[model samples]
Target: MNKTFKIYAVIFIIIMVILALLEVSKKEVTDWRKNFDVNEKSPFGLFVFNKEIKDLFKNNFTKIDVTPYDYYSEKNKKPHNILVVESEVDQESWNKILDEVSKGSDAMIIATRIPKNISDSIGFYNSKISFEEQNVLKLTDKKYQNDFIELDKFPSGRGFSYIKPNVQVLGKTVEKNNEDQANFIKATFGKGNIYVHCEPLFLTNYYLLKSGNVKYAQSIFSYLGDKETIWFVESNTKESSSLLRFILANPALKYAWWVFLGGIVLFIFFNVKRKQRIVPIIEPLKNTSADFVKSIGNLYLQEGDFHDMMAKKAQYFLNKVRLDLLIDTQNLDEEFSKKLQLKTGKSAELVNEAISLIKKAQDPYAGVMKEDLGRMNKLLDGILK
Candidate 1:
């Protein structure tokens, strides 16, 4: 218990010191627009932040910052409505929001563009551009009645709208063409409410400095005002989990390290400062020179290499016989043939050719062919017989 306490004390001190240093150095989140010096804020702070959005939602909505990192905790919190803030929308994530909203929950999305595939899935009415508008508008056309529910009407020429099943256009862009205008729309999926915003500028830091944006931001939250629970979803999210907390909570994962350490310690204990056990060591006996040659010769004989060796030995014996028989050293072939006929009952031709073959074996590159070796063996056997 005392050792464990010491270990924990050392760990706590180290963590405190590291955290203190981090607190001294403020880092910016590069991808996101830094609003109000994020270095001054907690690393976990900020969800959807822009100067324009901060000013608008700053007063009414409590700053409850949720992120993908805090997904499980926020998921556990079970907010009344979830807001997904993304620069782009993907089908899977969009579908997830829709499914959640279909349960009568509320979800709001703020993005640059929503794909036509998504509109097709939820069944939205497609409208061609008639003209450009500056103020947010309502489509008074009766044909788009089932497709759009106007929250605010554009003042002059400001908004573009599209209609589809279960979806409605709330606001449109006046500065750009109908196809090019930024659109803010809403759709219903299952039991949930989904709000889709076209442009991020209206909620960003730069746009918030403008005059009418505060009202725009207010109107957005007002439409979603009743959602008790809220979430901000980043675009194209796959399921993920928190690593540190997960390992700490799972005992089996933690125990694996202890097991590994224990095995290593046991190995060290067995290896060092351990008593040595005596064992017998037998020395190999070395053979003499004659014994080595005899051993090699016996091996060759057993393995059929002895047949070629025997043929050579027989040829050497014949050479000695040639000297003993007194054949001329230079013309031994014809002279040896006459002497071989006189000494042995074998043919002179066979004896003369056999002597030449054995002499040919003296060539460094020459070797016995399988058939010649077999013939040589037969000749030696016959001569010996």
Candidate 2:
């Protein structure tokens, strides 16, 4: 790998290590948002309350995932205390709850506000904004008149701004410096009672988390006697499941999938083989075999070895004659020259002279001269050309 690649890989590794350490060492912060989901464990959620609600009632306390309208639409002979916490009751649900209450089924709905239509019909109105962030409540009844519960961030939105004469005030906000404001009230229609509490945040985990504050909730829930209460909270009614949904439902699998995705991204980042520099153009070297042979010839000529050179040339020419002209060089005589003349299509004088030179060069004692070598070479070229 190149120097640049090595440096980048080191930086990438360092950054990854730092990120992993920070992720491991980071502290988990407390969530204070008012999400009233039954499964949420955050401070202002209903996880704790839902888990411990069964202790408040002695009879069968069933949890209905469906809305009150859907639950009450069917025939239920037994009396049940319907409990709905931290939710906006719709028109159909409100009407259905009223019908259920008229049929001797009690419903206690705790919410910051009720439907305006239902509020207008019953002459009960709750304010949408509360100037006070904290609240203290006092029960109006003579038996629990001195009972007071200190609360934080009370009237999540607002308290009861107006209450009808027929609806008896259950509890009111009391402050030494301010006048009392109606926070809780109950309206009796038929044989059952529909109690509306304006502060639903009081029943969340933040309040019940403290041992002392659990009583504040229990005191408020005391109105819901030991009867089978149907707790209706938001629920996912979806009947279909997707592959991705299944993976996300499991924490370990979800994190593993995310890690796999991250690995793909890192692999793509470091896969730099395709990002190389362009290659340089290079002309190929020319053929040098002919030049090498010319150099050897020049070396032999510089040595002035005419007799040896003549003998070497005679041997090579005779071999060529035997192979190409099909004339045997076993004897350099008149018959051989005559055959070569016919095969080579050369003059009789040229063929005869080359044969004579070959015969002279073959004799070692003949001492072939340079002139003889030149004339023989010319004669051989003329015969072969």
Candidate 3:
């Protein structure tokens, strides 16, 4: 009972030790998971940070609505007095928007980098201009004044320029550290006016809150008055994921079952070869094999086998005792029994009785009863343990 209690206590302590170690671990957000939920409109994107223009327009403007356009869904909207387009505008979508504006509707497009055709018309590549054109802009608070319209800037031809000859230039390619400063032009198309901004960052939440670009937003809003304003927010949506990008990112396509079969065939032809070798056998020296015998005996004992099982086990142990003590069958008396009992730590009477039973037991092969085997096993284990 005490041995069993110790075994259980050791097992329980091991389990508790493992549990205590496990309690020290903590999990954090991975880069992939963090980047997953980040969208263009997310707080991390330009939408959350730029506040100067948004605040100015939101309070003064009576009717304000926003629509997102991709390659599709850029057509067939009621004409408005003011239009704003940011981000990538598909060729077809912009053409449709231009068509609407041609019908006397006003618009403002802020592109850090204008498209090739539009940029060409505005002489974007001309060396006469003092600045490089790009699509994204970065503006500092010092660069922007109460009159300045801030825009976001990035490298490459991502700055603003004017394609329309009739458009009135607000701020030309100014000699400054800010790459975003470009031809902020206002053009008259038919009966309506169009404002083409080089940078859209002024409208973003970040610039709105930091700089006084809110004044420019208020000016744009005041020009349009209470007229319904349409803000076209472009998104890639369904057409955003390119097939080439998909194929590159997903390598599983290269290792499909058919592909794997083809790879196996190539490998077999180029690399695999059959070879012959000899295997050697090792013979082990004999050692005391009591552990193997005890394991097999324990299995049989746990199965509750009766009759011959107990008699066989008792005979096996009795033979070992006889060999160790050199006891002869004819002279197996009290002195021999006492010597065997002293060697095995068994009671003298029990050892004698167990030996007698092993020698005189009925043949288990001749249908010996299970109850008699049980009684014999009880006696044997009592002496052995």
Best by TM-score: 2
What C-alpha RMSD separates each model from the true structure? 28.4, 36.8, 33.2
1-385: candidate 2 lDDT, tens digit per residue: 8787678668766766676677668898988787787877888888888888878665468887777788778856566688888775678988988887788878887877677888766569755555676777667777665556667653453567778889888887765556777778888868888888777776787777865666666677788656778887766622237888889778567766766776677678768456778889999897799899999999989999898888998998988888888888897778887888788888887777788888888888897778999999888877777
- In terms of lDDT, model 3 sits at 0.51
lDDT of model 2, residue 236: 63
The number of the candidate with the highest lDDT is 2
Residue-by-residue lDDT tens digits, candidate 3, 212-261: 55565555445453555555543332224666556644545422433455
Better of 1 and 3 by TM-score: 3
TM-score of each: 0.36, 0.61, 0.38
The TM-score-based order of candidates, best leading, equals 2, 3, 1
Candidates 1 and 2 compared by lDDT, better number = 2
Return the number of clashes found in candidate 1.
38
- Give all candidates' CA lDDT scores: 0.52, 0.77, 0.51
What value does the lDDT take at residue 8 in candidate 2?
66
How far is 4's C-alpha from truth in model 2 (Å)? 7.7
